[model samples]
Target: MDLLSLDFLILAGVMLAAGAATGVLAGVFGVGGGALMVPVLFEVFGLLGVADQVRMQLAVGTSLAIIIPTSVRSYLGHRARGAVDMTLLRNWAVPIVLGVVLGAGIARFAPPSVFMGVFVFVAGVNAIKLISGTRRWDIASDLPGGLLLRAYGGVIGLLSSLIGIGGGQVANIIMTLHGRAIHQAVATSAGIGVLISIPGTFGYILAGLGQPGLPVDALGYVSLMGVMLFVPTTVLTANLGVRLAHALSRRSLEMAFGVFLAIVSVRFLYAMFAG
Candidate 1:
């Protein structure tokens, strides 16, 4: 949280760039940067000698806290592009909202290390699937797809509740593999991320009360300072990424982001197992 010297300024600049790139990738892929952001935050928190128990929480909580504003603006940007399915959102939102609240409440009481392990493992599986070109996009029909969508949202809510990120990866992977157009999937996924993050962020915040030895500048495990610094740049960058997607091939971007997530997942799992 200190910005007293040139070193702090340099770190801040790096983090800012990270935040912006994070959002761009999120918008481009509907990932909300969790795959990258948590690692970045954990590395930073580790450098700061943040306690072991609280480090992952700090990473998770801080990322979610940052996404609140960023996702709102990003969602609106996508909505403007006709990428979002507002009707679809209305259908999915009700169950997702309820599920998110339940998930957050669980995170508030769950064990942090166990939570981090699960997050790392799931990300690893998803990343591996992407890297191996083994992803499937098949869906039965509207009824099955709707059920699948609800399930994705539910799982995303639960995961995001614990990890403090937008649930875009889950939504993105599911929808894209199920034959949703990439642009629409990414846009709709961002909206889903926004929906889940709003509750998940606060859930992580409240959950931090279950562990009091977190960092100084945090609300629960999330750094309020990190959120304040990140949200603005991320919002702008997400919009930029959306614009770039329009001018570029979305399949290419998905492959790229998928590769990136795989790398990140490997790193996260390595750290988790190493620890």
Candidate 2:
């Protein structure tokens, strides 16, 4: 756990590469990088000998902390393109925060197996939807208002926090179903990641406070080393992802995202069963 040690240095380098890759995915898929980061962090934590009981929590928290900056960068990039839907973001913010707090509390008591199961399940669902090209499917012409909107936001936040994701997949699905354009849905999802990460990160910290077996230099469950290693690289590469997102056709992006989700889901499922 020594920050200056060779092991930590090597881990940092690995995490830097992971962060760069995650940033591009975040920009392209609006997923806030957690879908990728959590699994990688889980493997790294295991290698570092993090205690089994706290490893998942640390990974989830650290992923959210890293997301804050990356989400902001992606949001800015999308905004410049006039793709973001600010009204939706504003309407959903409060409920999303509330749900994130609840999710952090749940994560504090939930077993790692439960978190892994949830990740696999959610990723599977997302993969199926993307691959099926269901973006135009709709339950309504516009998003639900008032109580329904709050409920939807809460669900998005709850699920995202559980899986350490940015809630983009869910948000994009909902928005597109409600008649939003694919590009707009993606852009707004980046903003949702910012909302989710800010509150979710603090909530995890509070939830993990005084918990046992956390790695060194941890703020509650949030790994300072992970944040240090991840943030800069993600920020630097996110713009490149945004450019790619703009270049690709909507169908191409959807297919690519589907393939990525399938890979991630399989990885988590294998980890869950193998353990």
Candidate 3:
């Protein structure tokens, strides 16, 4: 695809709009915008005639790059309200980063079909959990500590990196189930995005370094154009999402997020089967 072409400019505009929406969702749901951005990026890259072999990798990597800034915006917004759990964020950082490195390595070698399948499955399960409004289940009194905490962080980081997310969904689930307030969980999840995206971004870059069929202005599999066009809008809208999150009731937020996840899941499933 011609980076200078009219079509590319139009697509870049679309990406900007998507990034704004993603930022709001990231702040509101603590999803880090990856769940929303990855699929859209994949489609955009496909439209640009990116090779199938590297297209999903590019999408995932670029989505992570965008998250680097968006998540920071979200964290700041949530922190200002005193909703963030700094202790949890501090404890989870190391393991999550390690997991991101592992996940990025796997993503580099795995086929697009495998990644798509994993995304569809995880998103579907999370959507069902959100829709059901089941908060009674509790296996622990609080967030795990010591080795268990590290393991949990590792799993969240691994799955999040593989799917190009900020690890918010899984982190929220863990925190909520362990008796954390919904607001705190959502706030802390933004920090988790920082932990995951930093390592995941570089990992993808190293993994895809010297690879063929990448789009123009790419750093490894990450698209510079996508990052440039997306980050600003995300930064602008993330605070709005934080405001909305504070305003809404927990049940309302859960239901809305559930619907969003369902839509994402359905889209992935359709792509998987129809493509």
Q: How well does each candidate superpose onto the true structure, as a TM-score? A: 0.84, 0.90, 0.91
Candidate number with the higher TM-score (2 or 3):
3
lDDT of 3 by residue, 1-275 (tens): 67569887789889999999999998898778987798889989989899989998999999999999889989988888888889878888888998899999898666556766766676566567667877556556787679998898998998889888998877876776677777888899998998988889998899889999997789997999899999999999999999999999988887777787688778767767887
lDDT of 1: 0.71
Cα lDDT tens digits, model 2, 98-146, are 8888888898676657766766676577668778987444567888889
What lDDT tens digits, residue by residue, belong to model 1 across residues 136-181?
A: 5245323245677577667667766666667776666666556566
Superposition error at 226 for model 2 (Å): 0.8
lDDT by candidate, in order shown: 0.71, 0.86, 0.85
Best-to-worst order by lDDT is 2, 3, 1
Clashing pairs in 2: none
Of the pair 1 and 3, which is ahead by lDDT?
Answer: 3
So what's the TM-score on candidate 3? 0.91
